[model samples]
Target chain A: MIEVSEAGLLRRRSVVPALLAERGDMLVVAGLGAPAWDVTAAGDHDLTFPLWGAMGGAAVIGLGMAIARPDRRVLVLTGDGEMLMGVGSLATIAVQAPPNLSIVVLDNERYGETGGQRTHTGMGVDLVGMAIAAGIPQTMRINLPGEVEALRQAIHTSTGPLFAVVKIDPESLPLALPPRDGAVLSARFRGALLGPAAHLE
Target chain B: MAGKDWPAALFALLQAHRVRQVAVVPDAGHAALIRLVEASNEMRLVPLTTEEEGIALLGGAWLGGQRGVLLMQSSGVGNCINMLSLAASCRIPLPMLITMRGEFGEFNPWQVPMGQATPTVLEAMGCAVRRADAPEDVAPVADAMLGLAYNTFRATACLIGQRVLGAKTFGIAPQ
Candidate 1:
């Protein structure tokens, strides 16, 4: 029941690091705009996708990975604004009930990547409540830096489908990350997934 | 890919087309396919909270260099009215493979209003619509719709008709 509106940008920036430090290579992060920055900062290492512009695509990709490699963990990094754009997938995922899926929504209450043009998530649309309504097995709502470790623990020992709403500031961007497009990173991810050592890679 | 197996047909069709990522909102008609895709390592199934979220996911999936599809019930189509506007405005090529809910032989009252409005909404949003009246027809119809959506940069629909014979969910919990 944590409303994201309660937090500032810098305070929320810690979610990315918290996830990566906790999950390591066990997760795949995807989405648009600032959340990508979150993904890169968390990886400290780097990430790639073959994308640009398509907003809410990460959750599905994460869902796919969750189902394909049930042994491995998958996390979708998303924006409240981007997610509001692609809501139907929720109902679909709920019914499919993939146990490995964890949809982590970085609710900043605005399309920080889209010049702050307002979003439905900002106007009292409870995203955590919505995920629960959509049938996510577990839902976590937190808007403070202090809650990151607990979230990390939940993700590590998680028996999902878990929906986490980490209230972050819309302006948080990772430092020292280079720019990469969906195509460049996606090629690498594809190589990573399809390569000979896919199990070991 | 049998007559009573729309889900099989969907799986084979998507597999053949090399569709790497697929998205959907849960619906009785689409549940089986979602489960099958969820099991496939080669394909990515994204279960979304809304039809528009699937659209957005497809946009990002495509941006991430992956081919994508979206599935939803006819009633959910009504919820996507504004999102269709977002797709059109963003010029994102999102082709949706949706199940029809309120047409002939329909039973769900919840589907009637939006089911009736499904094609109209797509048309109004400048997306092209196609319907499938038989289970066997879904394969090629879906292929053509995806092709049209990708190549032409226009959203295409493969609407599932009630007459298309298949395993009906009837709101039953999947076994």
Candidate 2:
């Protein structure tokens, strides 16, 4: 069970699973560290390509997936620190506006990997506002436990290049790491997506 | 001569290879080819805010069964150092077409340091680096880079020299 305060923070462990519930054929790109663990904890599918590195690249990778596979939904799960590094990508994504793409920032407001240091979001930087300013058609600032369902629904059914910032409780949890080998991860993902074509070229 | 129409020739080569995505951080040297890619119905031109985004985007494109190429200026190479690790580590087939700056033509002082460091940096990151000093060399170098990248699943870069792109000139303001 998770509790939401007036300060508006939800547990990452709960919110991630809620959002990924019944994730039918969605291709997911998870950022390095906690987001990667978060997605793996939800369930490690061949469809989920969890990054061990490339800290700022999660959202753009999702953009490429959305563009390449218009028939499939693409979701990027990342943290506030990672998202800030690649903030410039929002402008590029806004212009492309791939309807199948959705980027969710789990704003724990701290870099959980680097000894839980305070990130810009902890100091009151607004990721949702940045996304809105970048012209993403749908932007969500999800703060309460009750609001998780709406986000899950929106992810399942929405006309979007949507951006959502979930204010997550900055509590470090035990590791749930996916396979660390990038080549293996890549081959599995490509094979799952492209089938025989992946083996060819 | 191949030199006179290498941009078009290069675009045709990319098309022949079925490069569905063209990722670029717009550079004046790539203007002619960018126009061709933009006008093509076969490819989608993705304008990136920085060179690193192209690296990640193209990596994802490959994951989704589409081939992509990145075009950037030499100075932008410095921005891609950390991100290039993704391509190298993942063994993603990344073919980068880079235009040289800060070398040759005696131009801006700021661009020189990065321009000089470009090849060494890329090589250090485990990317195969190639050079094209003449217009005729551009297509061949790019073709080889594409082959090396796709066939071997390696990160490769073809640095088109400043002479091939023609030196950028400085002058008085145009009214």
Location of the lowest summed lDDT over 10 successive residues in candidate 2 chain B:
B166-175
Q: Score the docking of each candidate (DockQ).
A: 0.15, 0.82
lDDT of 2 by residue, B129-165 (tens): 9999988899999999999999999999999999888
Fraction of true inter-chain Cα contacts (below 8 Å) kept per model? Answer: 0.19, 0.73
Q: What is candidate 1's CAPRI-style docking category based on DockQ?
A: incorrect
Residue-wise C-alpha lDDT for candidate 1, range A20-96, written one tens digit per residue: 67455564665667766666654533333312455555566565556555666667777787677656567766776
Runs in model 1 with CA error above 4 Å? A1-10, A43-51, A117-123, A170-179, A196-201, B1-175
Comparing to the true complex, what docking class would candidate 2 get?
A: high
RMSD, every candidate, angstroms: 8.0, 2.3
Each candidate's iRMS in angstroms? 6.8, 0.7
Top model by DockQ, which number? Answer: 2
